[model samples]
Structure formats: structure tokens, C-alpha cells
Target: MEMNGSNSNLQSDNKQEAVKNPGDETSGSTAQDESWMKLVNLQLLSNELECLICSSLIFDPLTLPCGHSFCRICLTRAFDFALKCPTCRAAVYMDPLSHPTSVALKALTQQLFPE
Candidate 1:
């Protein structure tokens, strides 16, 4: 009888271990996958929000006539050198410092990256 009880206990322990181990591994894998996806998405967003000249998050974004957007400070500095679109090389006659900020884009960027 004692032999049978010991065998049953061992079998139950093995069954619990089997179930617990797989669950642990699966949950760990799922967590890792979620974190990886979040990091990839953040990198993509960062790339989109990055200033072409400074390669940093665009602050005080300015939209040009050619529909390209860049940070006002970066564009102002570039215009100081030569008043032309950095992305397209189109002639920019207007003063970059007097250009208005792209309101929708600025709001979106601020909401997404407040820091």
C-alpha cells in the first residue's frame, strides 16, 4: 500500500512539473515577444519623428512648400547656409525663421513623446 501511495505522489509531482514548466516557458516567450514588438514600434516612431538635419526628435516642426517637415531650428540653420529644401533641394525663398509651425504634427509628436 505504501509503495502504491509513493508511486501516486511521484506521478502527480511529475504531471504538475510538466504542466508548470510549459506554462512558464510559454508565458516568458510571450512577454519577450511583446517587449520586442514594443521596441520595434518605438524605433519606427522615433525614425518618423526624427529631424533630417539633427537626427533627433523634431521640436517646433516646420512644413515647407515642398511638403517636407523639419525642426525650425534645424531648418533655420540650414537656410542660413543656403535657402533650399534639404530633402528635395527645391528653392526655399521664404525665411525659415518666419515660417509657421505645423500645428497637427507638433501636437501629435508632443502627445506621443511628452518627455
Candidate 2:
């Protein structure tokens, strides 16, 4: 299948947007607004890290061929019912081991929620 460069570009844009210059001056309201935005972004990111099947933060993320990711255990359990993707109902031919863990996603989740 053709690669989608747009996803990479969007990820880079999000990385840029997440960074800020602490030295930059801002009014009280502006600072508060920035804080609120940061909180909203954090929540959105947390939601993205959550596994649909388990309804918890993904421990070992595994991205299916359909481009949907889920916790490894959750996906494995799902496979017992049907060899189909939980999100899109796409047919899954290979075993769960064939799908590699998303290292970057796992590290990001660990870093963000160290507790």
C-alpha cells in the first residue's frame, strides 16, 4: 500500500506545537489560556493512548495492519473471539506475534504517565 506522508507531517507539527518558550512574556489571562490549552492537549493525547478493548492506557501497543492500535494483551484476547481487528473488523491472517510492539508509543506512554 502507498505510504501516507501526511501522518508524519501532522506528528511533526504536533511536536512543534507541544514545545513552548518559557522566556516569552504573556499576560495573566494569556498564561491561563495557554495552561488550559496544554491541559486539553494532554487529555487528547491520553485518550489516544488508551486501548479501546481494555479502556486503559496501552501497556504494550501493537498496531494492526488496519492502522488501529491496541494493548497487546487486549488484542490477543480479542483474537480468541475472532481473527478480526476490533476497531475496523478487518480480517487478521497472522498471529499476534507477527505484529511488533510500537516502541515509540510504549515509551511515550511510560514517559507521560510514569506513576
Q: What residue pairs clash in candidate 2, if any at all?
A: none
For each candidate, what is the lDDT? 0.87, 0.84
> Can you write out model 2's per-residue Cα lDDT over 19-90, one digit (the tens) per residue?
544444422236677799899998999999999999999888998888889999899999999999999999
TM-score to true structure, per model: 0.68, 0.70
Question: Best lDDT goes to which candidate?
Answer: 1
Model 1 steric clash total: 0
lDDT of 1 by residue, 1-115 (tens): 9999999998888767766786666334477777998999988998998889999899999999998899999999899888899999999888877778899989979988999
Q: Report the Cα lDDT for candidate 2.
A: 0.84
Estimate candidate 1's alpha-carbon lDDT, on a 0 to 1 scale: 0.87
Residue-pair clashes per candidate, as listed?
0, 0
Q: Which candidate leads the pack in TM-score?
A: 2
